[model samples]
Target: MSKVKIAVIGCGSIAQHRHLPEYAMNEHVEIVAVCDIVEERVNKVASEYGVIAYTNYEELLADPEIEAVSVCTPNYLHAPISIAALEAGKHVLCEKPMATSSEEAMNMIEAAKKSNKKLMIGHNQRFVASHQKARKLIEDGELGKIYSFRTAFGHGGPEGWSVDGKESWFFKKNEAFIGAMGDLGVHKTDLLRFLLGEEFVEVGAFIETSAKENADVDDTAVCILRTESGIIGTLAASWSYVSKEDNSTVIYGEKAILRLEEDPVHNLILQYKNGEVVKCELGGIQTNEEGGQTTSHVISHFVQSIISDTIPPVPGEEGMKSLQVILAALESKETSKIITIN
Candidate 1:
């Protein structure tokens, strides 16, 4: 049982926080290399992990020992880095907002298909215990004919979380390519689709930069989404929750209303039409309150999928579909019309 040798491209916040630590913790993985345009950061991470340091991603991807890579770079670079990794015969675990565009996402997918390598996207919300259980209950007919869902992911902006605070790449349109929609919204979009087992077919959005002084990117956004089965909902993503975050979802059904990631103690609460209530304690998601201490199952899942020769739960295609919803919402915002997913 040889370990999967993996490298992480981009030694930024996410790489330092999730990919580097999680891969180091995985028994089936060996963090063999790390790359970042910033030499100091790359050297720091590689030296800490006792691995090779590469200032260029191309150089890092050249290693024959590296079986996979985690692309934790900015939004604009996800597609190119992922495509190069796949072409170099390496599996890729690209960060959320798989690409800046659906077309770019599709290119990444094509590269994976041609390479026959696993291309997982870092949409780890699907691994949340409460969300997973809710999906199961819905599928098991406990919820009964889900009508709508309202999901939101917001915080006090990326200033507190990003490595560079307010001046981070997150607020730069050229670097980020998007703001909260791609950062936080895509996570919810993917999670909602995963939970309800449906695709968003239409979108209407109101995106704005109402907060975050000097930041050109949208600090807040609200999108109206309709799924393939006519299930409609509002998806909100914002960095303007100055006090606390509201990373919660409520699903309405004919028989019950399921609340996810809302309650402090329960984590999930369900109230039936007959007045019966059930509270379930579930695993927490990585959030500002926790300073992201909770474990994300993404690394383990990627390793296990490779070991088992199976597809990842959040494959590139799945990520692309979810990303498309966000893309549509962006178009809707710009055009002032309901955009249909093609």
Candidate 2:
């Protein structure tokens, strides 16, 4: 099979750290074009990857040779760019929190359907080995009727990471839409949905800017969610944690409680009612260019899905479902009441 010629539509941190490197490692992919609003970013990445560079995304999308695109743009541009790419006869893999609003996310999904192209989102947590193993255990009846869950993803802030530093799109309301919840909480929301096999029905949340000094969006937020199956729990996220908390989820079931952390040791720990505890450690599913490494397993899955014409684990609609939870949480915060997903 010929290599999948992919055009990347954002040359930001995520594009550089996760997507680009993963593409370099994948034998079946060719990074053909790179685009960014900032010419310097695109130039640098194109030079590194030996691809053509474009300042305008439309120009990049117009290239018929590109088989797929990775929409790594800001939160506000996700839907429009993805829709355009799909309409241009390219499959799309968008970064998560799929869109700022449910309506926008719906439009992107519809575009993919209309175009008959695969649309997957970057909710990489589902590909983590420990998370995958625990999900299977629950499905296999090992957890025995799961009752509740708690998930969190927090970090210090995007100042050190974003291209524009503290003034990055992440801090701007128009660009980012929502803050910590959209940035990290969305990952947790999606992971819970995937692991628990449930849709969020309602949410009550307190979203606030408690820690990031002069941020226009929330730095810390907490949400309580009720699933379609009546399972309820909390999802917390922050850019305020001095010490970053890598994403983690805990599930309490009738027979046991399952805990998972992505840090120091990526593992699953289960405590049973009979006072027995089991720990399974699975490492190196992901990597960070620096000291910390996260799971890159999702990138491999994306490659496999494209090659096999299989549905990605985090498909467009599944990504939309997760975004709905985050949007619902924001709405819940605004209304000060439980909000429905519809």
Best-performing candidate as measured by TM-score: 1
How close is every model to the real structure, measured as TM-score? 0.98, 0.96
lDDT (0 to 1) per candidate:
0.91, 0.86
The clash count of every prediction, one per candidate, is 0, 7
Q: Write the per-residue lDDT of candidate 1 for residues 48-105, one digit (tens) a residue.
A: 9999999999988888989999999999999999999999999999999999987899
Query: Judged by lDDT against the true structure, how good is candidate 1?
Result: 0.91
Instruction: Name model 2 segments beyond 4 Å from true.
Output: 284-289
